[model samples]
Target: MAVLTVPITLVQAAKQGDKVAFMSLLEPSLEPGYRLACGMLHDSQAAEDAVQEAAFKAWRKLGQLREGHALRPWFLGIVANECRTVRRSRWWSVLKWPKSEHPVETSPDSGLSGIELRRALRRLDLNKRMVLVLHWYLDLPLDEISAITGISVHAVEGRLQRGMSELRRLMETRDEN
Candidate 1:
């Protein structure tokens, strides 16, 4: 399902001490947030933890959100930062890596294809992978992605292009196997 952009009214209401409203604002961003966290962290449990922490931080910092601003980008920024924190934890590396979560119902070829795609994605540097996932998977607009990533639109564009080029090359090489 496509994640709808959070309504500006919800953003305003959430800023005014409305907990329900605050959660309402976050509702639309939840699925996208989870997907982002999963893509970044590569672990369902870690993704959930990251999203939960980010949601808590988003609520606490709701007041800091400016009136009429796009909540999705700002909120996504928090989620991205939370994922970074999770990845940086010393224990994160010492622990066993997450097991592959193959799709239960997919055809064998498609399932293997997905694994290959994910592996290719993981090979990209975080900065490039981040832009590719946000733009392709999350379907976020360029300006919103730029804002969330704290980079210029031009830079976002550059990263998206370079990331896609690299990802394509990796996939082609894998297909030769």
Candidate 2:
């Protein structure tokens, strides 16, 4: 449900060494940027870093942004790229010890009280996680998610459906337990 209305003139101004314009251009995206980073990284610190890095990248590439195109997806593409970079740097070690090897067990009084949902979400492959986060948390449409992640629209839709189904199953199992 993000409706970006910032004008191309603002972006053009930002591209022409206008710091305030750039800030204005970047402002609306800050919240979703953090959310996307946090959901994908699942670590507050890493998420912050990812958002920071994404902001820098966006600044660097602001000129490449097309007129009339919304900025959110462009910004998200940067965040997703940062997440991939950070994740790849640790790919070897993480692959050696997959997080899914041991599922997260929830307990009563958990603040995240819906720990099963979080666990199941975390269990999904990175592509599925990205799709789910963009579609569910960010409320991005499948076309927008596909644009942000550079995947096919159908692929994004499939991942979202699969991720939701998996999450539901996990929640149901947790309730039964």
**Which structure among the candidates has the greatest TM-score?**
1
Candidate 2 lDDT over 1-177, as tens digits, reads 544656878888999989899998898888888888778777666777789989998988888888888888889889998987887785634644324432323355765656556777777778888888888787888778887888898888888898888878877777888
Would you list the C-alpha lDDT of every candidate in the order shown? 0.83, 0.79
Residue range with the least summed lDDT across 10 consecutive positions in model 1: 99-108
What residue pairs are clashing in model 1? none
RMSD for each of the candidates: 3.1, 5.4
| Stretches of candidate 2 exceeding 4 Å from the true structure | 91-113, 170-177
The digit string of per-residue lDDT tens for model 1 on 13-99 reads 777778999887888788889888888877787888889999999999988777657778888999999988887799987999666
Q: How close is candidate 1 to the true structure, as a TM-score?
A: 0.85
Which one wins on lDDT? 1
- Provide the lDDT at 152 for model 2: 90
Alpha carbon lDDT at 126, candidate 2: 81
